[model samples]
Target: MSGAANPALLLGASLSAMAAALHLAIIVGGAPWYRCFGAGEGMAKLAQAGHWWPALLTLGIAFVLLVAAAYALGAGGWSAALRGLPGLRWVLLGITAVYLLRGLAPWPAMLLQPELRQPFWIWSTLICAGYGGVHALGLAQAWSRL
Candidate 1:
C-alpha cells in the first residue's frame, strides 16, 4: 500500500465502526430500541421476551460491520497486516456492492410493500448510500496497490 492515507476509506471505516456500535447499543437498549430502529415488532417482542435470537441476529450484523471496517482500514493503508489479507480486492468489492444494494433496498420495498414504508427506510438508505460511495471511492483510489 502507499504511504499516503486514504481519507475516503478512513471515513468509510469510521462509518462502519459506528454502525457496528449502534447495533450493539440497540441490543443493549432492548425492545424499544429494536422497534425504533425498524427491526420490526416481532424482533422487539422477541427482545422483550429475552429470547436469544434477536440479540444473536443483531450481533451477527455487528460482527460483519466490524469486519467491513477492518477491511476498510486495511485497504486505506492504516493496517499493513490487513492489507495483506487474501482476496482483499474481491472482499472489498463485495462489501461495496452489499452497501450499495442495501442503499437501494427501499426502492423495491416501496413498490412491493408501500404500507411498510417508514422514515427509517429513507434515512438508512441515505446512510448506506453515503457509506457505499465512500468505499467505492477508496477502493478506486487504492486499486493498484491491492
Candidate 2:
C-alpha cells in the first residue's frame, strides 16, 4: 500500500507472460498432436474432431491469467498493496529467468527429437530471450520505484 508501482514494469511482465504462454501452447500442444497423428487416418480423424481446440483454449486462458497477474503485481496500487510480500517479487523474477533460459537454451537432445524442427526451436528460443529481457528490465524499474 505504501510502495510505489511502475506502470512500465507491469506492462513488460504482462507481455512477457503472454509470449511465454503462446510458445508453450504451440510447441507443447502441437508437437504431441503432430506426433500422434502424423499423416494418417488417426491424424485426419483427430484433426477433424478438433482435438487441438483444447490446447488453443488452454493457451488463451494462460495468457489472460498471466496478463491479469502482471496488472495485479504492477498496475495501479496493487504492486504497492502487495509490497509487503518481499519474496513474491523475487520469485516472479526467478520464474521469468527460468522461462527465458528454458526457452532460449539449445539442448542437443532436441536435435534427436525429429518431431521438433531445429529451426522452430531456434525461433522459439529467440522469442523467449526477448520476452525475458523485457520482463527483467521492467522488474528492475518496478523495484526502483518501490
Candidate 3:
C-alpha cells in the first residue's frame, strides 16, 4: 500500500513529528520553561549558573524524538537510510516498544516534593500508547507487503 494511503503510518509519522517539535521547543524554552515543566529548582539554578544542563538534557530528549520521527517516516518507506537496513521490522518494533515503555513505565514519583505529575503522566502514557500502536500497525502492514 502507498504510504499516503496507510492511516497507521500517517498517524505514527504525525505523532513523531509533533513529539520532535515539542522537544525542540523545550530546548528553546530554556530554564524557565523547563522549570515550569516540573524540572525542579536545581535545574533552574544550574541553568542560571550557565551549566546548560537544562538545554543539554532537553537536547538529548529532542534527539530521541528526532530519531523516533525518522523511524516513523521510515515506516512509510520515506527514508533511504531506513530502507536499506536489515531487520528493519524488528527495529521499528523496538522503537515502538521504547516509546510505549517510556510513557507507561514511569512511576508516580513526585515532580517536586509532594506533587506528582498526574496529568502529565496520564497524557504522556496515552500519547506513547497511541504512537506505539500506530507504528506497530504500520510496520506490520508494510512487512506484510514485503
TM-score to native of every candidate shown: 0.94, 0.51, 0.75
Best candidate according to TM-score:
1
What 10-residue stretch in candidate 1 is worst by lDDT? Answer: 109-118
Give lDDT tens digits, candidate 3, residues 1-146.
Answer: 23444567667877887877876786677678667665677887787677867778877877877766666666677765655555556777888788777666664454343555656565767778778778878877787643
Task: Evaluate model 1: give its lDDT.
Answer: 0.92
C-alpha root-mean-square deviation, candidate 2? 6.5
Lowest-scoring 10 consecutive residues by lDDT in candidate 2?
34-43
Identify the runs in model 3 with alpha carbons over 4 angstroms from their true place. 1-5, 107-117
lDDT of 3: 0.70
**Could you give the C-alpha RMSD of every candidate to the true structure, in order shown?**
1.4, 6.5, 3.7
Q: Which of candidates 1 and 3 reaches a greater lDDT?
A: 1
Ranking by TM-score: 1, 3, 2
Per-residue lDDT of candidate 2, residues 1-146 (tens digit): 34565565566556656654654554355546434423344544554567775456556656654743554364324555555545656665775676578666665556777666656566656666766666666566665444
Clashing pairs in 3: none
Q: List clashing residue pairs in candidate 2.
A: 1-80, 1-81
